[model samples]
Target: MRNVVLGFLGTQLDMGKRRRWRPSISLCQTEGFHVDRFELLYDRKFSRLAHDVRREIERVSPDTEVLLVQMDLDDPWDLQEVYAKLFDFAKDYGFDEDRERYHIHLTTGTHVAQICWFLLSESRHIPAALIQTGPPRGDEEIGTFDLIDLDLGRYDALQQRFDQQTREYGDLLKGGIETRNPAYNALIDRIEQVASISDAPILLMGESGTGKSELAQRIYELKLQRRRVKGRLVQVNCATLRGGGAIATLFGQRRSHTGQPGTERSGLLREADGGVLFLDEIDELGMEEQALLLHALETGRYYPLGSDSEVTSRFQVIAGASRDLATLVAEDRFRLDLLSRLNLWTFRLPALRDRTEDLEANLRFELARAEKILGTRVGFNADAADAWLRFARAPDTPWPGNFRDFGGAILRLCTLAPRGRITRAQVDEEVETLRRRWRMAENDPDARLVGEVTDLTLDPFDVPQLAHVIRICRTAPTISEAGRRLFAASRETRTSRNDADRLRKYLARFDLTWASLHDDT
Candidate 1:
């Protein structure tokens, strides 16, 4: 009897998929049996990719044991995202949840597998050795083979490689962020504090464009570098945590005591054991999860889904939210207890409006960053910078979107700019675009005024609209009567002021006031 190897090929399995899996030469000498059918599952879209892979797997290997090789193209280097997707697929397909039967490989290529494996196993202390015999001296064997149980020194060498690779990636990210960006500096201070001191849960409050994640990453890196924290910094966006398995994902669940049952996958908190768990959009966490989180924070203990055994992991928690948690607590949307626990050291990121002083610096920094990212030299001229400053300082301008908004505006200006330097006109145009979207633009002083301008253009008005309204008001019996008559035409136009102060201001701008008419007499 020949051992039949059933493989369900995913993304990299496609004919065009670039990898070292050259079946023609590699599998040529398999004597007893041949690959019965090679199902090709490939798609550019991710949702379709998973479905296609699953469908083809079922089609090709309906009964025989299948080895799944899943390709997660979303973030090719992100092992966590890839593993989560694979775990979900296994559960959705009712794969036995026990242990040790299925081999699920995530590979971009033969060489990439080792790289991915290195990254994935960096934090874990799994006892294993990978000894690779390079290509034969001659053409006897073209590739490499791995031998298990390497000497202690060799295993340590592999670990050192993992450390080196991890450091290289860190340096790359750090180099990208080393700048005088004021926002970056403020974020650096917060990250430093969070890393150095583990006394309280740090709450980082900022709008969406403020690079909350970057700050978190910096904090994690700095902490690891300074030897303040030992474990990995596990980040989880609460908005993405949804449905029944969310708790299971937060807390590890034991393996089903049957064939090939999936083993317990460590939750982020567990993974971050001695480090910081950065929770982005912490306000969006479900009520139940919030309560569970509160319990953990209070007692410093949590029960993983399948096990009654309480797992104790201590680490600093850094929670980021777009809104103030106090309001959420007031609305009963968030638990006061959790809010209290997380209120240790709260840092609210200044909105772009609040940090207007730093606008010029930020624009220059963002422009350079954008240029680097786009692989082009995009610059701002003196006139363009002046225009942007004027717009940023305009009374009608409200950057509700913050730094992100400015970045987008600059990018648009770059696109509209003739050569490379963005112009004042482009800045104004983008400002108007922002104004319209955010309703921050001052309302055009009434279309009726425009109509009056047109009419005045043809035949000059004997008196301005303000003068006409005052004339109507003067003839009225009382002040109330005057208001009723003057505002009657507004019913059809729906022109009204939400605030009396605004109305007063609008009237003041026209140099017309009740006192002006009274004094005119």
Candidate 2:
């Protein structure tokens, strides 16, 4: 079924204002939807305008889905009151079906696009998400903001490009726009090489926030630019693959069992047959499924989940895994043969810490992103930079979480930074808060057997020592196992014993003992 997005452009409030509605108009036209009408709602405030919008909704099409759109002023607008207005209007107009048919999109032009998700009760903010217009902004007559598309698929594509370009510029451009990192350049070079190839299963391995998916898409686009493929890049999260029968869900299930009468819809793999298939977290696939995938990759064939008939499908396979495949294979959790098959062309994306040269560049990239997102300029003060420099090089804590963690901390400080500059104290406070919260959470019974190790001083001297302790804790099955890892083997066993004794004393001093190991206890 084709979904229709209908938006009402001007309000009485915007009538006299230097309004740019042409972009919105052109966008609707280009989107190829049947526009019933575009009436100007002149009321400025929620109380007055909502009633008029409700009337328009009923008049337009009482039975169809109506998405009421509005401009976000960034100023304090009473959201509770705004929703009340929409609710009252929907109730009066009889638009409220069991499942909410009427939707509201609160957009702030080219700035931050605030969303009011249709929850049953109230609307809350979805953090770290923003919306902006596309390039060659002149295409939209209502300024670039008029071109903001609310379609999820289109939005995802646009935002993906924006993030990528922003990062690229952060690395390549002058004036601190791009971040320079050896690892990023290396990964980009690898992506270029993969893009040059047309038929090879590529394995992308990295920690969670290392931009694996982004790199995968870049490879696809590069391939497309090189005239190697013509189909859309179809992506599936293997972590979320399910076993529900009725084959139609994966490929479009035939509407009916009778072949002659059923619709022949395509499965995701078929949809992307000529393009690329990106399977995220492929390590999550069960052994039986892994065998199926291996067969498909080897023979260019995959049967629908419940179908007896086999289908011929060929697509460039790009898979990502945060876990170490060698470790998974050793543990018998993942297939070694399958890994060998996909590892034909492999690229290991390094974590944020491994590329310290790129930290400044990444920070600049993220800061630009924040400015674009927040509709305001934001920068790191000398103090904030020093604080980051302090921990940025920690061998024991070089961001196991990678870019995602970096983005989060940067964003938090960006938001909290007064007058667009993040202070050193704020950085220190945030870091301490993070550590404290982590320690508190570790006290939970469900917490795993891991240590939150950090160096007291940002100097590189203690990093490896701290990391040794972390490695010892992570590999240990029990206190005794940890003891073994810490103490096993050595001609000069005295040093090992001394270190173990010192570590045990340190743990005791911090009230962290073997019993604190949740996975064990």
Candidate 3:
């Protein structure tokens, strides 16, 4: 195969006395080196010098052919111009890897040109290895040459840089919170990879306050930073989109019969074109809305309310659902087709209570955020901090509202701190307040359900647990479905996982049955 070397002419370096050997000349005349052809790029102003160098190359290496190509540059230092010209050259070049070996002469070009050459070669725009030539060491005219292959995997420094960048992106997605949970970190890593590469619909499923909306926004921001999206992110809560105006609110309305003809509305979907549409609580959307959404997702075309014409929108969807969308689909509440389309990249974010280990880190982050919000610094005393951390990490701490509840607690503490310091008394007060709130919540639902179903005085602890189970039973279509949801995490480890059997036994202890719970509900 013929060996081809391509480079820019180093006008000053190649124009010394005839005896002096330069980078381009030395590369061709090096001992034991064979250049079948040399493609030299030069400005039109250096046409005479380019001819002189080509003649010298042919004279020394009689078997080699030198092709002089003109690439006029008004300013060699302009990186944009240099890169664009070189990119165009590479794009137009007919490279046949099977017939010839190509090398990019990196030593002769300007620093900007050298950088552009590196980028082009690294990106495989120019399928070539980079070759650098330097002046001879002792008495040799043929100088020294080093070949550099742009394989990132082979370079530890480059690999580390890429790894660091990936870590930074993950941190950004997490709002700079130094989350230490292994499962959560792994989840973020997967999310980062998907957000960077895929434009498909992503569904984020988690309980309320579990950061679904935050993560969706982060995904949009990441895509924007990576230049994947050019339009703004349009966020809307599907739960609020109800009744007569839901369709118009989402798909927009055409001009009224009595209004101007050209004043047709563009809608949220149109506004989200070339960007992301975050539909929080997506399961709450009506059947008609779901059908329209599915159509838009599949075809990128939808009609405005009262309009005959169909408008187009090219957008990606990031859906957030607190409820089990699969269950909703099973119950015939949500459209199966819409769910299927959104489920391609579904991720379930673990609730705060499920990841208690990360509570301390999240608490500190919330504290920092609160300080910024209140424009005042606040810190817990040594004993107070320990007490709060202990209570926050306790297994029984419901944290039902997740980070939302956690952040609110932090803000309250900061606001009530005396002399910008939270003492044990303040911590005790806050803890009591949280306990009362949780107790009230338990009594409100549990007491009412238990009171209506049967007249039984139950232990305080059992009331909340049994109330939760009964609530799930009331909503789920079958005992098995309710059991599956309640024991989702624990069932994974059991050898013989019969959720229905387990749920039945637990309910039997309370002298209750799924049938009895649903009878009143």
Candidate 4:
């Protein structure tokens, strides 16, 4: 398998244009790095330089192919835009070649570009080794280069100390939720380390259904199994913890004298003493609660409601938020100090849509759970399994709800399956039900309107194209306008035509019209 090299074309003119050009890419080829293909990202203005560099590499090493990628990016000096462009490039380029390994050339780009590459590799955003190339200092050598894996715990001399400790815990975390993504795998290992050694707060930031709560509880379990924490795990959804009772619920309260003789209650903080307290949706905490919580987290002291003396509760905190806490802090809704404390070991869980590669494994895991729950063994027929997996993993299936959606879907199938056996026909029927359900749940007025007018009797195969057409009809101001855009390419030679009537008649196939689609949902 040949290696694919990704790099940037540097603009530094240390070597004059007329001088004997010694490009890093050319040196890389000459040094026999075996870069079967080079994907160089550069600006439009650097076309000539990039072309010359490519030509030089091809001239020096005939087997190496140099391909230039044009980027529509903002200031090259701006790290934000540079990082965004690089990030977008990584997302857009499909790295589907199994035999070809990727290696990032960090020596031939701007400082910002090099930094972005290093960060991306470090975080496993780019699953590649960092290649540092430089001009040879000695007279006897070609350009000097070295390959470094971002995971120092994997290949470094200190592997025995840092890497070996978390190896078992890494496996444990993947017991239920299986993932093959390098970023997520590395994240599990990192989570194991923080959950094992440090008692400092750990924050899991990601969208809902990305398994934040599950991961939080898993962290506690890992700690408990290792005898790191001898107490029970206390979990709370802060979103549901609002109102006057928020303070009493979180910090406990003594018996009330003024009210109807309320009994003393142990709040979540006290219950979480000597253990891990996982707070999901931590951003929902109001400012007053935020202040009190910050004080308790910082000093381990909080006066329970209706108490004069301050009580102490020593507990490890782990917080999860679907929204960005920094933005909340900036908006003065959340405490900056609390944000600072929790930001120490933050990990972002990727959404299910982003981890579609793990669909098969996760789907099987969900089926196993359904079996345990229903106390009956269930299995999907070959055709049924294939059909369901295809729909679930399709690009258009925006898994806004993530894993929870998968669980619900599996439960529906398992509940309806006869003799614990799911057939292709059942899969097809359930798929249509889900499609109509999704259409009904649409929040957008135009999409909802389109869905209302859409004929569900149409063949399932026609839904994709029809759905797009309905959306176009709802958005276009006039029937003629919609038809013109739809027939733009085909009607290029014939500018004047009755495209409106054609489109109107086309919609009649589904018992619809342009006017009906534009109605509010």
- Model 1 TM-score on a 0 to 1 scale: 0.47
lDDT of 3 by residue, 1-521 (tens): 99999999998888855447677878887776699999999999999999999998888888889999999998999999999999999999999999999999988879999999999987889999999888877886568888887666568888888899999999999999888889999999999999899998999999877998788889999999888899999987675565555677678887872277874667789899999999987876889889988999999999888788898999989998888988998999998888889999999999998887788888889889988999999999999999998988888898766777677777888888999998999889878877766666665877545543443446778777887887677556567878999999999999979999999999888768776664321
Q: Pairing residues by index, what is the TM-score of model 2? A: 0.49
Model 2: residues with Cα > 4 Å off, grouped in runs = 1-184, 243-252, 255-265, 306-308, 437-521
Cα lDDT of all candidates, in order? 0.57, 0.57, 0.84, 0.77
Candidate with maximal lDDT: 3
Q: Write the per-residue lDDT of candidate 4 for residues 1-521, one digit (tens) a residue.
A: 88888887776631334233355554555454677888878888778877877877787678888788988566877899999888888887777557888889887667888899888877777878888766646563556678777665665767666566567678777775667878888889888877887888999999866888778878988989777888888887675455556688789888862354665778989999899888878887778888899889999999998888999998999898989999988898888888987899999999888888889999899899999989898999998999999998898887655776677678778877999899999888877876765665475443433344442345545655677776666545457777887887888677568889879888888778765554211
Question: How do all models score by TM-score?
Answer: 0.47, 0.49, 0.65, 0.54
lDDT of 1 by residue, 314-409 (tens): 887878898788999999999998998888788776667776666766677778777876677877778878877888866666675566667767
Candidates ranked by TM-score, best first? 3, 4, 2, 1
Scored by TM-score, the top model is 3
Error in Å for residue 58 of model 2: 91
Residue 450 CA displacement from its true place in model 1, Å? 33
Residue 494's lDDT within candidate 2 is 66
- Model 4 ranges with Cα > 4 A deviation: 1-165, 256-259, 444-521
Alpha-carbon deviation at 220 in model 3, angstroms: 1.1
* Worst lDDT 10-window in candidate 4: 13-22
Residue 502's lDDT within candidate 2 is 57
